[model samples]
Target: MNIVVDAFWDDEAKVWVASARDGIGIATEAGTMEQLQQKLSIIVPDLLAEDYQGPFEIELIARSHQTVAAA
Candidate 1:
């Protein structure tokens, strides 16, 4: 199984926050990008293993911002 992670620093709180779109949250104040990535690497698999089952499919629908705004 493969998953994508998005990580960034939270300036106000002074911590690294990481999350997978599939719903894993890894937050820490360890103070380095590598540390945050390592932590997330460990946590995401366990989180997905607990929540996900079997193969799944996703669809992406693209539309102009103006079209969405008009609706």
Candidate 2:
């Protein structure tokens, strides 16, 4: 199965939040991108094991925003 995870940096929360779509049930948040990725590594397998069988792959898509002033 192909799992797609989308991550976004929440400035107010000061953490990276991620969610899975397209039939993948996943939602989590972490202080950093690395932490978030690590969480997915463990959480994904457990989630998939419930309904899916055999090997699975994950595709992560992340988005972040920042404002820059003209120099």
Candidate 1's residue-wise lDDT over 1-71, tens digit each? 55555556666676666555555453344356667656655665555666776343222111212224555
Q: Candidates' lDDT values, in order?
A: 0.51, 0.88
Model 1 spans with C-alpha error above 4 angstroms: 24-30, 50-71
Give the per-residue lDDT of model 2 (tens digit) for 1-71. Answer: 78889999999999998999885669999998889888988998898887878476778899999999999
The segments of candidate 2 whose C-alpha lies over 4 angstroms from its true place after superposition are none
Model 2 accuracy (lDDT, Cα): 0.88
> Worst 10-residue stretch by lDDT in candidate 1?
58-67
By TM-score, who's the top model here?
A: 2
State the displacement of the C-alpha of residue 59, model 2, in Å, after optimal TM-score superposition: 0.8
lDDT of 1: 0.51
